[model samples]
Target: EAGVVQSPRYKIIEKKQPVAFWCNPISGHNTLYWYLQNLGQGPELLIRYENEEAVDDSQLPKDRFSAERLKGVDSTLKIQPAELGDSAVYLCASSLRTSVAGELFFGEGSRLTVL
Candidate 1:
């Protein structure tokens, strides 16, 4: 199967503008994920989707960031009114099952630069 795929490998936007990233997880994977990685930091879980439902999103910043896994096949992460502090790499990952049972496959992240 193909690995997770993410688009717009890089983006630059002014503060307060809107930006979006898209992802397509490996076929047959039931778990889709979004992670945020800031400079010099390890990846932080932002959200996890089990099929079409968002099963875990405690770390997601609801006010400015929103995500959806459409039909459990593709996903999108959007940041509206972006802030300079939001500049970071947005990673899309997937697994055959839950984290405990399967290894995660990560895409080449979409890097955002908010000026």
Candidate 2:
């Protein structure tokens, strides 16, 4: 099966501008997730999708961030009016199930820098 794919591997934007990132999960996987990882820290879940349903998104900053998993195959994460604190690695991961211990395969991530 193909691995998760992400684009732009890096980005730089001014604070208050809008930025978007993309992800494509592994084939045949039913669970997908978006995570934010700051330097020297572990990845924190931003949103999760079980197929097309967004199962968990409590960690997402709804005021400036939004996401969608249309058709349950691919996903997009958008940050509008970006803030300096939003500069981090936006990683996309996928798994076969929603189990807490399920292993998530991660993409290289889109690294964002907000100036």
Candidate 3:
């Protein structure tokens, strides 16, 4: 079985430009998550989806950032008029089952650089 998949592994753009990242989670995995990691910082949860419902998105910036899960399978994250502070790695992860000791599978990630 395939792990999560993310597109545009790397992206470089000038400030104020628009950028979008995509993710395809593992099949039959009802839980999907999008995380952002800045340099020297741990991944912070941007959003979490249980099926088609966005269960958690407290950290997501609605002003210039948006995300969606289609049919609870694939997902997309977009940032418009990106700022220099927006440079980070967008990670997608999925888990078939969650337990105290279980692990989550992560994609290669989308690394964005705002110049």
Candidate 4:
């Protein structure tokens, strides 16, 4: 089965610019997540979706960040008017279920660098 897919792999932008990243989850998976991993840190959940519903997004920065999983298959995360502090790896992961114990499969991620 195909694993999660992300594009650009890397991006460099000046502060205040808008940026977007995409993700395609594994086929047959019902749970998808967007996570942020700062250098030397573990991935922190940004948002999670069960099919088309966003089940968890408390960690997302509402003022500047947003995400969506449209049609229950693919997802996109956007950071508008980016800040230098937003530089990090945006990882996309998927699982078969929404349980906490569910194992997640991750993509290479879109690495963003804010200048």
Candidate 5:
């Protein structure tokens, strides 16, 4: 099976600029998630979607970040006026909702750098 796919594996921009990353989950996976990972730390959930519904997004920074999973297939995360603190890896993961262990498949991630 094809794994989760992410694009623009690297990005660099000045502070206060806008950036976006895209993701395509594996076929038939019904759950999708976007995670942020800083240096030396594990990934932290930014948002989650069960099909087209955003079941959890409390951890997302609403002021400058937004996400969407249209048609319950592809997803995109955007950050406007990004800050230096936003420099990190944006990971996209997907899984089958019926998995007993809640296994997730992750993309290689898009690394962002704010100048």
Candidate 6:
């Protein structure tokens, strides 16, 4: 089986611009996750979807960010009017199921640079 796949490994935009990222999780994986990582810090969960349902998204900044996992296969994350502080690495991951210690396979990530 293949691992998660993400497009546009990197992106650069000026503040107040919009950007989007795409991800394709492994087949048969029912759980998908998006994470944001800042320099020198651990990755923080942005949103988690079980199939087409977004089960957890408290950490996601809804004001300027949005995500959708259409049909529970491919997903897209978008940020509008991005701010300078929004620069970070956006990661996509997936697993067969959710568990306290379940292993996750992560993609190379989409690095965003807000100028």
Model 3 regions lying over 4 Å from their true place: 97-102
User: lDDT by residue for model 2 over 1-115, one digit each (tens)?
Assistant: 6789999899999999999999999999899999999999999999999999999999999999999998999999999999999999999999999776688999999999999
Encode model 4's per-residue lDDT on 10-105: one tens digit a residue: 999999999999999999999999999999999999999999999889999999999988799999999999999999999999999877668999
Tens digits of per-residue lDDT, candidate 6, 1-115, equal 7889998899999999999999999999889999999999999999999999999999999999999998999999999989999999999999989966589999999999999
Instruction: List the lowest-lDDT window of 10 residues for candidate 4.
Output: 94-103
Error of 6 at 108 (Å): 0.3
Lowest lDDT 10-residue stretch of candidate 2: 95-104
Taking all chains together, each candidate's TM-score versus the true structure is 0.97, 0.96, 0.93, 0.97, 0.96, 0.96
lDDT tens digits, residues 49-115, model 1? 9999999999999999999987999999999989999999999999988956689999999999999
Q: Which wins on TM-score, candidate 1 or candidate 3?
A: 1
Better of 1 and 3 by lDDT: 1
Candidate 5 or 3, higher TM-score: 5
Q: How many clashes show up in model 4?
A: 0
Inter-residue clash pairs, candidate 2: none
What's the residue-level lDDT of 90 in candidate 3?
Answer: 95
Cα RMSD of predicted structure 6: 1.0
Query: How well does candidate 5 score on lDDT at residue 7?
Result: 93
Q: Write the per-residue lDDT of candidate 3 for residues 3-112, one digit (tens) a residue.
A: 89999999999999999999999898888899999989999999988888888899999999999997889999999989999999999998765434256789999999
